[model samples]
Target chain A: MQLSPSLTQLIEALRCQPGIGPKSAQRIAFHLLERDRQGGKQLGQALTKAMTVVGHCQSCRTFTEQAQCDICASTKRQDSGLLCVVESPTDVLAIEQTGQYQGVYFVLMGHLSPIDGIGPKEIGLDILENKLQQGGINEVILATNPSVEGETTAHFIAELCHKYQVNASRIAHGIPVGGELDLVDGMTLMHAFTGRRTVSQL
Target chain B: MQLSPSLTQLIEALRCQPGIGPKSAQRIAFHLLERDRQGGKQLGQALTKAMTVVGHCQSCRTFTEQAQCDICASTKRQDSGLLCVVESPTDVLAIEQTGQYQGVYFVLMGHLSPIDGIGPKEIGLDILENKLQQGGINEVILATNPSVEGETTAHFIAELCHKYQVNASRIAHGIPVGGELDLVDGMTLMHAFTGRRTVSQL
Candidate 1:
């Protein structure tokens, strides 16, 4: 059966979300029509308000409605002359969830993938360089994912940092929490064995 | 970290969509804040437009922006003597995808369930009764799922149709096409064997 043009368009637009396929989109659209008018209105308002008002913090590149995000604006956080760089705002959230990192973040939006035509300019390497030049960031933590493109991006960023006279280090690669050796991927297993620290030495 | 009241509220409001877990919701909210301004605007416009415009077709109880949805409005659809009854708009779409069924549909929106508090009135059973009384419908196909609740709903509707002197039939339950008999659940196997058709007149 033919749906209303607007309804069809709404489903099409909702398809952009990562896991929402055509069937799921239709189900969501129908559910929106059937059950939750209030939810629909709230969703609309939230989407519009957030996209219009929220922006990147000038210093840390974290999202903020002001000139700087709360972390960047606060005087209380220990600066530590360190900056932790990540791939996306989602990755920023993941790191923040750890509660271990005290430094600020610089989100690259995506890793550089030359094969996919994604380059330094596409992923905002220039922005990182500019931020580094603004001073006080002595150490850079390259926390990109442990994929090929991520590794390439990290190495490129490290070389760039060295040229700018800044110290940079790639985050450790190993088996994740609760991971068994048999279940871990080959690269991670190799990394874990190679980077193993002796308890007796410690 | 504590978010602003408005930001927190907006994030909370985005929880209505299916498959959007708390972390995913937070990530999406952050993505809208960091980038995707145009996407957010389009999403809002699409949502609000669909919600304000789409409603149930008066006759079939399916979603539509018009007084009657396309299926109900089409003179070409075989409205002759058969009506397929289904649980929701999703079911309507599922039935339509077959291209085999020529009849129009009557959407119940829900099934009969007392524990969860869904009842006949909630699903507009009386409306179906009224339509049955108006006649011209020779067969009513109960196309609800094979779940216990669906069976209960079908039985209830079938009884009502019988009271109105109308023919009612439930869709057969059996092993699905390409299903392995060894892997089939015991109950389904029993149903499949019992509902098996006679291939030879031996």
Candidate 2:
């Protein structure tokens, strides 16, 4: 059917979302036009504001409106010499939710994917290397995902940390706390076995 | 964690969409800011354009950029004297997709709900009444949904048609095509039994 030009434009624009398809885009467009015009206007204003105002934090490369992100500016966090490197800001939020980490962060925003032409510089690795060479960090934590690209990025950063004589560690991998052994995948089970520590060590 | 003010505002604005809660809103907001800034900007422009340009079609109350909707303005439809009354613009799209109905539509956009303070005038029932009284329409098809409010609106419109000396008809309610009898609800089964017609009559 020939939808109005404005309606069609709205639906097409909605498809930019991660999981939204044509049908979902149409549904969202119609919903906004029909039932929530005020909400739609608010969303438009917010999108414009975010696009114009939000930018990468100067210190950590995470999204922020100011020069540095809250974590980078805060004085409350302990161990300023410890740094946790993550793939994205969302990962930063996830780790912060745990409240166990007392260090700072370096947000890569993406891992190394050579086939997609996403290299070290694309994910701000050069800036990370500069930070490592500047020599304040005592330890570097690689908290990237267990995927192949994440592994490559983590190893690359580990090499940089070694050159800087900083301690580098990867987060442990294992079956989740409530997960059953039978449900655990073979790769994870093998990693668990190989990474196991003695009871006395624990 | 303290998200940037603009990021938080964007997330809050995203929650206005139906079925989108806090997490989904956050996800959409981050996706726009991190991965699809161009698309986000396009969406904002689309929203602004739609809000400024789109309005109800003067004839049918369906969304259009013109005075009359395509269907209402078209001379190709077979029955100019037949009017199908539907609950929403989406319902109009659904019927058009069937390729069966050749009549023009009068989009109410909502069903009558007395408790919600939505009366006849609120859903353009008075406009429909004026159309029926003016007397070009020979058949008024009540295609509102079979819900309580839909039924009430259909009956109300039917009464108005009777007063105006016009023929009124309700769409049939029956077991859906390819649907098993066992899977059908009791109310629908009852409706099927009561509204049954012989093949010869058909």
Candidate 3:
């Protein structure tokens, strides 16, 4: 039987998420109808509540329920003149999961993909510049993913940081541990050789 | 940075769906926060709308916006005095996709799993029996899956149909076309051999 228009629409909307194909979407659609009516209600409520209540932090651009996100507002974090920059709130979450980063984050909201018409203004590079001018950040770590677009975006930010007389460095990329010689690609193999560290002889 | 309480809660709630692992759920959570704000809002609206607007059809037991589902209410469909009973809406979708059947359906919504404490009343089998009795269905097609639980449930329903004096038949089972002998399990292979069709010699 045909599903109700609202459920059909909901399933359609759900399909926009990554990896949610039509069949999976339909399964989830029917599942919501079949079991956990309260969860279905909660899904609706949470979506609405999050969209309306949560917004990007003005300072770091991370998602916040109030004027600023918890990280940006926190007193415990080392404002120790360090800030890690990333492309999205999910990236922020990924970094947070590591539990190694005590410094704050600056979310670009997106990268500098000029071909797609995405530029500095679109990704809020101006905000990063403004935050730099405000002082206190001694080191800016370019934690964007190691892709062509990400590298180009990082270079653009690094150049801007140099212009403002602020120290900046991109996150490192090299051969992974336990990588075999035969499995390594040409460029990575060359880079790994060049960047190899000296080992103490027995 | 840690997500806000609402976002954290949203991701937690989205975990109930099949195949949505933590990472996928997190991605969807942040994706809703980043892009498609309107889509997110619409999803919530749709969920609430579907939950409040649609309910189970009394006759067929399919979830419907109206008292009777569209399939059951349709005048175009042939009411061939036969009813096909299946476990869930997913099963209904599967049967509809085949496009081979002309008659309508009766959704059990779930199977009788006594170990899980699911009984006739729990899955509304009693309601289905009443509908079948009132409609005077000449035949009842048991279209449940071939799983042990499904077969057991089908047989239980078949016994009830026989008691009511309604003709009941199980859907056929055999090796699917394009299926390889090596991959075919013993039970299916046996069925395929037993139910082999006669062909004219070339």
DockQ in order: 0.54, 0.75, 0.72
Q: Model 3 residue B110 lDDT?
A: 80
The ten-residue window of minimal lDDT in model 2 chain A covers A72-81
lDDT of 1 by residue, A62-158 (tens): 6667887777666655367778888887787678788998887787878899888999988778888987787778899999998988989999999
Please give fnat for model 3.
0.79
Which tens-of-lDDT digit does each residue in B1-202 have in candidate 2? 7889999899888876765778888888888888888888888889988977899998889999999888878876525689999998888888989988888889999999989999999999888888888878989999999999999999999999999999999999999999999999999999999999988754
Model 2 agreement with the true structure over A146-189: per-residue lDDT tens digits:
99889999999999889889999999998889999999999999
Which has the greatest DockQ? 2
* List of clashing residue pairs for candidate 1: none
TM-score of 2: 0.96
- Candidate 2 deviant stretches above 4 angstroms: none
Which sequence of candidate numbers ranks them by TM-score, best first?
A: 2, 3, 1
Model 2 alpha-carbon miss at residue A88, Å:
0.8
Candidate 1 CAPRI assessment class: medium
Q: What is the lDDT of residue A201 in candidate 3?
A: 100
Put down candidate 3 lDDT per residue, A161-184, tens digits, no spaces: 888889998776678789888887
What's the lDDT for residue B191 in model 2?
92
lDDT per residue for candidate 3 within B1-202, as digits (tens), equals 5678998888887787777888888878788878878888988898888878878888788888888888888665535777898988778878888888877788888888899998889878888778667765788899888888888989988998988889899888897889888899999988788877889899
Which model is ahead, 1 or 3, in terms of DockQ? Answer: 3
* Alpha carbon deviation, residue A49, candidate 2 (Å): 1.3
lDDT tens string, model 1, B144-193? 98889998999999999999899999888888899988999999998888
* iRMSD for each candidate structure, in the order shown: 1.9, 1.2, 1.5
